[model samples]
Structures are given as C-alpha cells and as structure tokens.
Target: MSFLFNTYALARPALFSLDAESAHELTLKSLQKAYDCSLTRGMMASRPELPASLMGLALRNPVGLAAGLDKNGAHIDALGNLGFGFVEVGTVTPLAQPGNPKPRMFRLPQKQALINRLGFNNLGLQAFIANVRKSQWRERGGILGLNIGKNAVTPIERAIDDYLLGLEGVYPHADYITVNISSPNTQNLRTLQGQDELTQLLQPLQEKRKALADRHGRHVPMAVKIAPDLSTGQVDIIADLLPRYGIDGVIATNTTLSRDAVKGLAHGEEAGGLSGPPVHELSLQVIARLREQLGASYPIIGVGGIVSGRQAKEKIDAGANAIQLYTGLIYRGPALIAECVQALKR
Candidate 1:
C-alpha cells in the first residue's frame, strides 16, 4: 500500500498524459509483469479480512472490483493481491470481437467521469476461462464473479445462446456468474431488460444452472446487471421478476446514458455509457427503489460512481449489501478499497 500510493502518485501524471485506453493497457501489462516476476507481491496491501456473507457466498469484505476493468480475466491474481474482497471479470461474449472502435473511451477529469462503448470486447469464453483457471484468487478464498454478455455480432433474439454458452464454460470456475444484460455499448443489449426479454433470457439459464449445480455438486449464485437509465416502473418490473427466475442477486447498474450530470464537461457528448461521480446518485436511486420493493430478502450489489469510502457507505445506506468499484479506482487508486472497507465495517 505504501509503495502503490507513493509510486502511483508519481506515475499518475505520466499515465494520465497518455490516451485512456493506452494507459489502461500499459497498467494491465505492468501489473501482470509485476505479479509474474514477484515485484508487486511484496508491496501488496495487508488488512484484516472483514468476512461477509452475501447471496450464500462468504466474502472477506464487502468491497469488490467490478466488471469492465478486466474484460478478459487476465488480471485476476494481480487485482486480487490489491485487497478486493471479490473480483468480477468480463462481460465476455461466447466469441471474440473487436468491440467499438478506438477513441471509444474518454476521461473527463473535471467531472471525474469516463464514457466508453467497449462493446464486450475480449478473447471469448474459452480464453477467459483459461485465464480464470490460472488465477490464485479462488485458492486465497477470494470470491471471483464472471460476467457474461452477448457478442456484438449476435442477434438480440439469439443472445440466449451466447449467455448459455458462457454459463456452461464458466460454471466450473466462477464463484458467481453475472448475466450482463445492461451494457449500453452493445446494440439492443439493454433491450434484454424488458419484461418478456428478461424472462426469456433468464429462464433457460436458471434451468441449466440447476442441472450444473447438481452435476458439479456446487450451486453457484447468478446475478443480473442492469442499467441506471431505467424508469421506476421498469426497475419495479425487474425487481418483481428476480425471485421468480431464481436470480441470486442484482447489480444496481452497468452505466448510464444520461448526460445530465456531466452536461458541460468534456466528452459528455460522447455516445456511450457514462460512469463515475455523475453516476453515484443515479445508481443509488435504483438501489433505494429496489430495496423498497424487495426488502432485505434479496441481495443488491451496488455500483457506479463510488470514488470514496463515504460514497460507498452511501450506497449501503441506500440498501446495497455490497459495493463494487471501477471508475473510482482510476481516480483514487488502491486506497479507495481500504477506505470503503473501513467505512462499511464500521
């Protein structure tokens, strides 16, 4: 922790000077190098593991690394060493695809936000599972959640095939599975949230999961990720249906398409999902609404725009059992994780 704060403070200026995507790629590569060579293993943060129970999975803490930061599961070990109670990787489609074109990611420092349309880009299901197999997080007792999505080329109606494929491939490895039906970057991907579409998408997956659990002798939980742009009625509809489908949890949001928060900031006009400070309140509203309808019986993984411990606590106050981070990590670094843990544990 001391090493990261000191070094990252010095290196942030240089990293921020590069394009967002390039900087991200460089960091991932560097983390991989450091972990493989044992350079960062010693520098990793050490904290009292604040054990928590959510959706039947026992976790070390409530703060988790959200999906999208590691689209391919390549950084599982490296990220796990940084002290997340859990790490979720991907939105990995059944097949590999290039995703949206470059310049698809942009940073708005002024608003503490990022906009991206990196449409489920990754090395596909097989590669993703292989990476997860190589990770040490599971051995260390860290919960690993694999998020699955449809490929850009897959038709909306046939999207179930991709998700089902992901379910079968990752079931043996994941601590939990995230069905990502909310990323706005993929065309009509958000449409899966609609009543009939969502039901159709989840029914088959849950049925298969029952068989998989019986075969593997492990019943891994499944969570659905949704967008923040939905209306109250729409959110209610989804909440009402979660229990019927046997979905174990719901991530309050993926990202928002609304520009209201970053209206005057640079890159606010970009045509993609927006995340960071601007999304904090929007995501909270969704969690609060879900909590109101579902009560404490269901679990909600709150995410979007949490950049500090206080902010993480706010999400819990709004009714999230656990919180995940992504955009905040870019702005605040590893320190945010401890801060969140402290706030939540207290």
Candidate 2:
C-alpha cells in the first residue's frame, strides 16, 4: 500500500499538471500497459476476500469501479485485478463524439471532488465493440456491465433508438446493461425522466431486452442510472416506473450540480457536475427515498461521495445491494478497494 501511494504521489504531480482530459488518457494508457504486463493483476490479487451477489450475477465484491473512468471498454482486465467486484464500462452512444471542449474536467484536491462535463466522449459503437472484442478480460468471467446512452445530437423523443442501438452492440458482452438518463452534461437528456417520456423510452427497450435475452440464451438485467439532483417528486416517479418496465436495478445519484459542500474550493464554480465528499448526503438521501418508494426488495447500487468503508456501508444500510466508486478511487487509490472490502467484512 505504501508503495502504491508513493508511486502515485510521485507521478500525480506530473499527471495533474496536464490538461485533465489528457491526464485521463495517460492514466488509461498506463493501466493498459500494466495489464499487458500482468502487473496490476498481480497487485490486486493480494487483497482480502471481496465477494457478493446481486441481479443474479456473482461479484467478487460489492465495491465496483464506476463507469466514466473507462469510457470505452478499454481496461477491464487491468481494473478487474484492482480488487473491484465489478467494472462498468462505457456511457457509449450510437455515434462517437469529442464531447465538450478542453478544460472540461477539473480536480479539486482540497474538496476531494471532481467536476467534469465530459459529455460522454467515446469511440462510437463500432470502435467500442472493437475495443471490447480485443479485451482479454471478458474471458476471465465476472460481473461486467455496460452503461449505455444516446448520442448528444439525438433528440430526446428519438432517444430510444440510440439506446436500442447501444443495447444491440453491448448486450452480448455485458453481464447486465445500465440505461443512463441522468447526465447533466448532455442537453435535454434528463427529460427522459419524465413519466410519459420514461414509459415511452423504456417500454420498447424492455421488449428489446426480452428479445435479446431469448436470442442470447441469458437473462441480461437492465438497470437505470439516475442523477443526484432530482427532487423528491421525481424520485417517487422513478420508483413508480421502474417495476412497470421490469428494470432490474437503480444506480442512485450520478454527479451533482450543487456546490454546497465544496463552497470555497478553487474549482467549485466549474460548470460541470460535482462528485465526491460533497455528494454523500444527497446521494444517501436518494438511496433512502428510493428504498422507501421501491420497497426493500428492490436492488439499488449506491454511488457518489463514497470515500471510505463506513460511507459505503451507509449506502448499503440505506438499501443499496451494491455500491460503486469513481471520485473515492481518485482520492484514495487502489488500496481503498481492499480497505472497503475488509471493512465491509467486519
């Protein structure tokens, strides 16, 4: 653990100095190399027991590396060894995009948060599928979910088409599929959350899910990833709609737009969504509210502001079946995975 911290500390200054987007690319490249050499796998394998089950898939643990860290299906094998019970890849769209302009992602070290309007930049479906096909991780077998989304240019009314396109491309490979409708970066994307719009969008997708399950001879559960900024009314609406569509799970609280927790930080005013320590309370609130509305049996995957084992446990106690991390991993490093796994055991 000290070695991991020291190495990252030495490298972090150089990486942090680069533009955030470039730094992310470099990080992914480094992980890819570590994976090719089997270094990351060896490092992660020394961790304590990390096993759990949800949505009919057995996970090595409940602590998963969230999507957006691996926008495309690039580093699954490398990340898998980092002690994550699962790895969610892609907010892949039907069409590839460059996303928002540079200086789009910013780090607030003091606040232990990140603010980014990355806008789902990805290699399109074809490139994404090619990348997934090249991965050696898929054969290793564990819970791998693909988070799907519509293109930036696609209208909300026709959003289902793009989701369908993404589903078709990723369904065969993903253990489950996540329908992303909450990103604040994309224009009008959140409108799909409306009752009428949600039903229209999900009904067709649910039918498609059934067809895909029959065709593939596997039951691929579909989970919905929602934003953290929702009002109580909106949360109730989603809880009401999820079961009607046969949705398998919900990933509560994507990045938040609120700056209440990180009020005085240097990058606090950045326009993108805020994620990390500041988001913990609101995220937990959403989880608790959803649990009440959806009933205790509904599966929920908690995310946002989970920086420690106790925080992760709070989400679980609030009714999350599993939890994922992005900002926490950024601030805490790989050792956090083992720490959370061990802490959960106690």
lDDT, each prediction: 0.90, 0.85
* Candidate 2 residue lDDT tens string, 1-346: 6665566667778888887678878877886677677655465353446678878788878888788899888787777777788889999998999999878999988888899999999989998888777776657765788999989898877899999999988998888899999998999998898889899988999999999999999889899999888999999999999988899999998998898888887978999889888888898999999999988788899999988989888888888888998888777777777777877888
lDDT for model 1 comes to 0.90
- lDDT by residue (1-346, candidate 1, tens digit) is 6677677677788889999999989988877777777655767655547788889999899899999999999999888888899999998998989899988999999977999988888999889989999888899788999999988988999999999999999999999999999999999999999999999988999999999999999999999999999999999999998888999999998899999888877788999999998999999999999999998879999999999999999999999999999999888888788889989888
Best by lDDT: 1
Model 2: lDDT equals 0.85
Please list the residue runs of candidate 1 whose C-alpha ends up more than 4 Å from where it truly belongs after superposition: none
